[model samples]
Target chain A: MSSLEELAQRVAEGDLEAFGGIYESLLDPLYRYFYWNLSSREEAEDLTEEAFLRCLLHIGRFDARKASFRSWAFRIAHNLLVDHIRRGKGLRKEELDANREADEPPLGETVEEEAEKRALRQALEELPSSQRQVLVMKYFSGMSNAEVARALGKSEGAVNALRHRALRKLGTILESRGWR
Target chain B: MSGRKSKEIKAALAEDLLRRVESPKAPQRLQVYGLQRILARAAYETRTVERRWFRNPALWRRAVVLPLTALLLLAAGTSGVYAASMDAPPGSALYGCKIFFERARVALTVSRSSDARLEMEFCERRLRELQGLPESGEYRAWERWSREYRRNLEGVDSLLDALPAEESAGLAARFQAQLEEHHALMEGLLKITPAPYLPYLQQASRECMERLQRLRHRHGMEEEERGQPRGPREEEGTTPVGDTGSEVQDGAEESGPCFPSPSYPQAELEDLAPYGEDTAPSGMAWTSDAEDNWGSSPKESNGVMGEGSGHEGKGSANHYWK
Candidate 1:
């Protein structure tokens, strides 16, 4: 079986240190997945912590035969996002713009390149929620199309269509902004 | 608008930009929030088979609820005795409560002036109680009250000494004026005072006089003694000079065994024995409000002969000296 599946089995048996291995493996994907979906970094981090807490609390119930641990974790993060949205806190573009200011340019990236990335972020915020979920899970969460579809409770064709449509919309947006 | 830019946007969306955005992992920032705590709790919880006694309501009632209930009950139970003790006289059961509460008041009072003022009130209270004692068969009660009264005086003395000259002046004048009135009341009591009790009353009166003069000298106030005789013997025409009243001048003031004075009315005698206890109703109490009210308007008190403090309680007491 996979290393994550082995860790999940040990976690079920109360091998405490083995749970750390699973946490380290899944922590980044869950954080980036939430960050791209939410307006603020703090919200992303809180939800990320919440996802892990739920995971550890119910680790004994995980069935590796049915799904990979990463897929299960992504499912939890997605349900939280859905619940967060249902609670009347969807992405607010104004806050998204405010939080985007903290993304300082990396070394060797030109000012023009940074501006292009900034424009891309704004355009990404304008996409529909379902398409953005598929896009964020596919690219940022390291999930295969099948895993992404399973986490979102959609078919593989639906996940693919949502991804392609999101990318095409992003491309059209960049073109409209006179992006090079 | 341009064909080349459109192609670049397409490529960036497909591969170039998504790769860069996917790798934006803030591992350090994530550590600051809560991932480490999750890891630690995961380890700690699974490592120990926690019995989770905190979840038991029975344990919570035993650990928290009972102690709080007991504390609240104790406070409510003692409040009655605490209230009654406020005016308890020297030999009464609640008298100790009076002294204890007075000391606690001084300790709790934050301002030095207010603290000194409180002690001054105690001094006055004790002096009035001492003066109210009967001349006959109350030597033990008299001595007990006299000692406590002197101690209260000493407390006020040190506190006054520590006060600024400006503040001490007004306070000493008021204190002297209050004592002057008490001296006058003592004179009224002296008209009926018997012979054997003369020396103790004389000596006590002399000590009070000395303290008053020291206060006047210290504060630069004019002597306002108003010609009140020092004690029963010294008051003119009340008792004969060469009679038993002469015992004070003959040095019996120091070591005399005082007897009860004659002609004391029974009502006044009971009132004197245990302060204003004779007039106070059984459920009536002295309160901090009396001290506070007297402090705010010391001039309003009708002096030692005035009604004893009327207070807010189930019953009211009106002290009488006539």
Candidate 2:
């Protein structure tokens, strides 16, 4: 919400009430971003908290003109994700399987549709982490190229090129699996 | 790939798939509650720090040190007993006065977690001081220092026990690691300690190590984390001597006469600012200049204490000091 920008200003002034408003707006998208990447609900939640805390502490450093509060917030979450991966704290395979089952389509899907969706999910998962992140932000989270670029610290042009390449690869994987 | 048919189909499919992938909403109660807790904690820490500063005796002393020195000397008939005891070594009469002063300090500290960590830091300094002591003669000094070491070790164990198991895990692991480092150094010192005083040093180290081993076991931490050996006796020649002094190197050198190193590093502090500026929105630029501790009132038994409480409150203080 546009109120997030105003909330950021208040948060910079040490208003925890304003921080609560910002948290409500961003928690879901940020949690979803991490969940899509890490495939672990608990870890995503933990990382979400860590990112928000860092944001609350360093809110003064944020310049709204440089990036939207959403993008700035995502940058914090992205850095945390990088650190988590660097530390080799990824989930085990069994945990991944359990999470995947829960993540399956909940209702009214034909078996064929669910299978196709699973195949597409696998294809996306097979992409490199950076590309996967771009796709998740662009597709699932619905962030625009400029926004994803800001969040990922890449140029807008770079994000567009990455998106094009990622979409081609996904198409290739779908065709290969005969899921198209 | 850019053909009209392919483009249309790809766009439609991408839209459908992305839309269909369900993104679960964050759990409202847990998510909101967690943020509330963090916000409440940050606000609470900011308030305590401000209160501590207003009520801080050391701050008051600095405001009129020269005038107070003259007035105290005129009134007390003897040099200020508490101020003079600041430099007392472990066994001296002044040292008891020093502990009494610390009782007030520990009482005023807002965070129980911080107090536990401070006690651990003291145990480390006492161990390093014990190692630095002469091997021959001065048995009285050695005994006194060893007694203080045991007392501080007890403080660490008891304070750690008082904290919730989850909250104390990181500090406890770090304390265990540093204790093992000293345990290694004590092994080296055992051969050289005066034969008469050797048993006292041995007993002090044994009790300290046994307590540390139990702490580690209780937390399910591995001894090999700091390269300490498992079970009671550490293998000779295995423990690294570097770590013993390494943990003691926070800006202790600059603290000079009065201030000792802080109990923990900025990173070890859970509820407070990292080091420099308060988390308060006072409109000051945030700088990473954590070269010194927060400059809180120095720990009571300074000067004669070990190297100093380095900025790395936990073993990670290894970063700034090393």
Candidate 1 regions with alpha-carbon error over 4 angstroms:
A1-180, B1-64, B135-140, B190-203, B216-322
What digit string (tens of lDDT, one per residue) describes model 1 on residues A1-180? 349989988888978678778777888889888878887777888888889987987888889888878888888889998999789675786667777677555567777667656675677777888887887888778899989988888899989888877787777776677764
Writing each residue's lDDT as its tens digit, candidate 2 over B102-127 gives 66667788987888877777777676
Residue-wise lDDT of candidate 1 within B32-146, one digit each (tens)?
5466788776567655434354555676688778999999889986787788887677777788788888888899998777887998898778766765565324334445565
Highest TM-score: give the candidate number. 2
Per-residue lDDT tens digits for candidate 2, residues A43-157, read 8878877888788877889998889988999999999999998888654456677877876454677787667656766777777788889988877666889889999999999
Candidate 2 chain A: 10-residue stretch with minimal lDDT: A88-97
lDDT of each: 0.63, 0.64
